[model samples]
Target: MTKSDFYRLCGGTFFVLVSNARKPIQSKAECYNGITSGLTEPEALLALAKTVIPDIPKPMNSEMKTLKDNTRDFKACLSNGGGFFRFGDQAVLKSFDVRVRQDYKQPLAAMNDFMDEFLDIKTSTKKDEYLVKGLVELLDADKEIGNDEIFYVRADGSTMTKSQILTASELCVQPFLLGLWHYVLTVVRDNKVGKDTYKDFCPPRGGAERIYTKQLGENSKREIAITYCDIDKTDNDFTEPKEHIPGENEENRAYKENDTSSANEEAASVPGTVINNNPFFLNISGGNNSIYNHVDKVEINHEARRDKGE
Candidate 1:
């Protein structure tokens, strides 16, 4: 694959993964394991890419740096490693690290457009045009110098052409990108950031309830109701109970009606009764002697009628 084609296919994902990998939120050991494992078994990476690619930002035009400057910096970051170009130069790497971190926080659509412009093969600046011409001249010189020499070698000790190496690099990078993506998502979810976007990208946390809310009417007369299963009940057959204080058994917990006892051991007990722990459930204070019973199910019935005056 050509460089532009590869970027078109995996550029957004590659940028996100590499930027996040530089500063993993999880332990370094775990992050490394995720990447290495992906390299061995690339199926996971392909699966993740299918689900993740759609959400990744598209390439946009960036004003952060001039095209000429960015292209020069990009070329400096790469070194020909006999067969292929590999990342090199500590200063260039550090520069990219800072740029990527800031780029990641930019509005998704804008950042995506910037990446596209950054990777564009056609140059708009005279300086960048000269750089591209110089690169072409270097490639021509290499062809003349190594006309009979083998340049590309595979892990299995087989020979490959430069074109084949480009395609191989695409395959190799997928696994590494997959590992980084996994670690980044884990950190984001754990820290509870990007809730509005990443929540849909990653799997829901364990023991999280799937609540659905519905609106019954419009304007002032609208009534909103939420529906969810009480997964804590025995009928639900959930293996794990809701999180609570350590050493406190949920089964032994008691619910008191109209009693203001501070001690758990002294509170009155109601057998086979479950408490509604949902935050949305109304809790009446300054007691007018009201007790809300927990029900296993709730059904809402609504009917619409037109007024005679209308």
Candidate 2:
């Protein structure tokens, strides 16, 4: 559907219901982008998954120098030997690495928007402490999570409680957020940076849990901009070694319609960087020693969600 079609098809507000109440956060509520409505999380996300048209806005000046390669924060993605798209910053690419994988452009834009919108979600909360307690207990019961793990949140307005994240993991189809989380957490655990060392990492309050970058040398002080998106955007303040660290294939698949196997430019392939190649579902933080070349944007298939347990 076109942008207007998306806007016309959506509802006023979106709600997520996982399990029965009594446990706060068992559901979540939010407004859509004033576009599609009443979309079960799946429907909204599927719509959001529409491929982006590759259009790398050109830098005004012709003689600018770029740092896409030398900069630690930027990561470039290539799909199936096609063109490449730079993530993190468009400005950086103009001066340093102006990759022209225009075909895979749509997926990069959509994927970034998808991931950004999913995480760091803003909502109105009702201050349900009881639900928080229950969630803490559930996390406490999780075997894979580390010992220092804890749920941290900050709410100001009216928000619901949880029966969702824990009790109804089955029904709670948080496609966008959970899928992004799966990829990120897998990267974090594999990198071992969030295990600690985060400036916002914390027993310290007021900050959300995050993974920080290690000191690259005796004179660097920026957090590395690491993520699962395919486009490269590094100004390189705190980037890690140039390496791929996922346990499975990381392809940039952006189809024009319901077709996953076909795309305009062979999809986006993030070159240079390789990640873990394992196809295991729920492998979570197991990409520590695994790294493979990712060639396209995330393949938005039904199986991609299943692989991520969305």
Candidate 3:
């Protein structure tokens, strides 16, 4: 379906009642102010299941709760990815991420295909207008290129045609944002950064960032430029190695006291840098060994509702 058609279809499926309320009227009310006047439970559930793009099994009470939870989780994912998206933010990016992560064995490939189809439908019509100019204007304005306005001129004349916008968003914005989310959630969350160095190694918040889309020659070879300033090394620097004392284990104590072999090996392994791989040995401040560097992964996922105390 085309973009408008897709939205209309989604909008029309509002009667699908997947809720905790068992009674028909309660379900109806919960669904949407008694909109599902004649829809039966089975029908409502089927529609609800269908409403989900790339449908999965029917949501039960707990699953319905999970869907609601997914909706909540989407925002935090978006925020962690890159603050927010202007339009179709959660619907396109987070929705795809959640569905693929929950059901598909491989998410990135599936998400890429999903976005491709999404853009194809949305951008079927091409205007003779100079699309690249609007694209540059949007990037110059530092606006989040969205799905619908993914094409067409905005009030400020700073938006690309659907085709150009989609290419830029997928290549530049989605990868960086989604990859940041994945890295933060999977890599940093799994104790990969060592508990002792957590405080020091946590990614610094905010940076001078820039992104732009470019077309090469008349062949329409498009590329996106992404740039960001590195965090100042002088502020809360993590590279400086602290003196590490040995642990209670006699072997470790002995190694620390007498063995320069491992240190030599590590230095050789990573030329021009000192190694502090041992967590128990670092000389960070007391009572802060297990303290996380940034917000907890679980907390980031669940923080939307919790922050509101809901």
What TM-scores do the predictions have? 0.17, 0.18, 0.20
lDDT of every predicted structure (CA atoms): 0.26, 0.26, 0.30
Residue-level lDDT tens digits of model 2 in 1-310 = 3211111100100111111111222123433334333323332223232222223332223312232221111111111101222222335333221221222232334444543343222223311222222223323333444443321111111112232333322211122222222222221223222222122111234554222221111122222212232344322232233445544333322222335434422443533222322443222222223333543332323444567676
Kindly provide the TM-score of model 3 when superposed on the true structure, using C-alpha atoms.
0.20
Lowest summed-lDDT stretch of 10 residues in model 2? 8-17
**Deviation from native of the Cα of residue 176 in model 3, angstroms:** 4.7
Q: Candidate order by lDDT, highest to lowest?
A: 3, 1, 2
Point out the worst 10-residue segment of candidate 1 by lDDT. 211-220
lDDT of 1 by residue, 1-310 (tens): 3221211111222222222222113455877677433221122222222222323222134622333243222222211111111123334334333422443222222222222223221333322222222222222222222333332122222333433332332222222222223223321112122222222222245756322111101111212121111111112111333445645454344433223243322322543233443434433323223345643222221211122232
Q: Could you tell me the lDDT of residue 231 within candidate 1?
A: 16
RMSD of 1: 26.9
RMSD of each: 26.9, 30.8, 28.3
Q: List candidate 1 stretches off by more than 4 Å.
A: 1-115, 119-124, 143-145, 148-310
